[model samples]
Target chain A: MSDAYAVRDNILTHHFSDGSGCIFFDPMDNSMVAATKPVEELLNKEKSESDEQHCHIINTLLIHKMITKL
Target chain B: MCRRIYGDRFTHSIQPSEFIDFRIGIKYPNFTRRFLKPQVQFSSEGLVPFTPLPADYAFAMLEWGMNWTVAMYEFQRVIIHSAVLAKDDYAILLPAPPGSGKSTATAYLENNGWRLLSDEMALITKNTTQVTPFVRPICLKNASIDLCKQMFSHGTFSETAYKTHKGDVAHMSPQRHSIEEQSTPANIVGIVFPQYSKDILLDIYPMDKTSAMVKFSENSFNFNFLGQQSFETNVHLIENTRQFELHYSDLSEVNAFLNEEFCK
Candidate 1:
């Protein structure tokens, strides 16, 4: 089984048309998280745990319930 | 005072059977206060929602009370604490904090042929890019109060309330054109965050959608309560409009920029 992070079911994502950034809205906590295009791409698929910036983003998403580990 | 400032805006009398959305009154707090150091209170539907202010501030309090009534109770539409102005039915939202030179810019734009949607709030229909006009007097504080008076010499103004929480406060009646088209709604075309700076004549920076959404959300009055709906509505707004941050000291320069950029 693979241990990957996936966006939470209740989280709503909106991607900008210009690919500049993305916004995630979690209704459960009524919180909004804004991510750059690269970070949004990283969240959409699999993320490597070794990169410090990626790790930090994942940790924040996890804390905000925007992403869940599987 | 209302007669002088409001002009013919309230020329039509309300019918006795007509429904009134808000029943508000600005009156002296007490009998002794009326004669002594007179203070005024704002009440809506028989409930006073704010502290009494000096009698000189009665009109200002009334305007603030009206804004409070709408922001506090009106939930059908997504309200942003922004000044909205339009040119030929295309609207631009100016979402900025107090002392951000929003009102000063709005006063200039509205007088310069742009229709004023609202000076304090942008009432956008739920999940739509359409913003309805909530036209009212533009509130001018401190230095802007005097500046607007000199700039628009023909403009009607209320009595100045000195030393209020928001500094010296005054209200300028919206142009007759705006008042006449109060029932009309405009399509959202752009969002501009304005900051007045003495050093900058005019400096505009294009804002990405993500940054615009985050900043716009911070200015929403009911974003937290509306949750997903508010998020979706805001996203819809950002996607459909160009966003920018404008820092300027000159109203004429700001006016020219908006006319060339968004108005056209």
Candidate 2:
């Protein structure tokens, strides 16, 4: 089964107009993560290790408590 | 002197309303030397009082009181500490530190066909591109007092109060057109951080969004206090509006640049 992760509760996303990236803020953890559109989209998708990069990113965020396994 | 010059600009009403929003007053303490050395004190709702000033500074106290009232009570909109002027519904925000000559530039721009949205506080709406107008007089300091008066010989100014904390201070009434259009809101088109220098050529520099966002957050009066709402509004605004830093000495050249760049 592919690993799926979603943004943790209390995480807010803001898309930048310059197409650089978006900021994810978690007030409870007092953290802000800059992510690209694809990364954010992957965040809402079903857990899948099919894309190793996306899976690694979600796994890293999970370690940081910024995301959770779906 | 202030009464003689800016009396007409103030909205004088003797009628008291139960729905009072801001109750600000300046009072003098009664003591043996009260008549000899008259002192002025400012308070809102009789709390958070300020130290006394000389009698000549009554007008300055009043102006500061107005600013305090708005900053303290007006929370519906995000308040950015900056000078704002607009033309054709496109507003430019000039956010700067003290002694940046922002007010001087604002006065010149307002006189030259641009509508003066605000000289101090920019009332930005929550989660929108609009900025509500404060539409009050601009505060001019020290050398700027003489500079503005020399430029606009016929302009109305409150009497100069010297030796205050910010040195000499005076208020310049916005043009009649600005006050007349006070009710209208303007869509923000850009943010300009101004820096003044003596006898220097005008210079324009493009600012990156990250830096602009950081500076705006710092300059905003209630950015952190409003928390998530302020964050969302600021991000939205920065994403949509262009940002710049303007360094200049001559108002004429600066005006030319602004007209060509944003006014169209």
Best candidate according to TM-score? 1
Task: Report how far off residue B154 is in candidate 2 (Å).
Answer: 0.7
List the lowest-lDDT window of 10 residues for candidate 1 chain B.
B3-12
Q: Is the docking of candidate 2 incorrect, acceptable, medium or high quality?
A: incorrect
Q: What's the DockQ of model 2?
A: 0.18
The residue pairs that clash in candidate 2, if any, are A2-A47, A2-A48, A2-A49, A3-A47, A3-A48, A3-A49, A4-A47
Q: How much of the true A–B contact set does each candidate keep?
A: 0.85, 0.12
Candidate 2's C-alpha runs over 4 A off are A1-8, A11-15, A20-70, B1-20, B31-33
List, residue by residue over B1-264, the lDDT tens digit for candidate 1: 888778876556898997778888888888999999999999997799998999999999999999999887888999999999998888999999988989999999998979999999999999899999998899999999999999999999999999999999999999999988899999999999999999776899999888888999999898878888888899999999999999998888888888888765
Tens-place lDDT per residue, model 2, B126-214, is 98889999888799999999999999888888888999999999999878889788889999989999999999998999876766776
Q: What TM-score would each prediction reach against the true structure? A: 0.94, 0.81
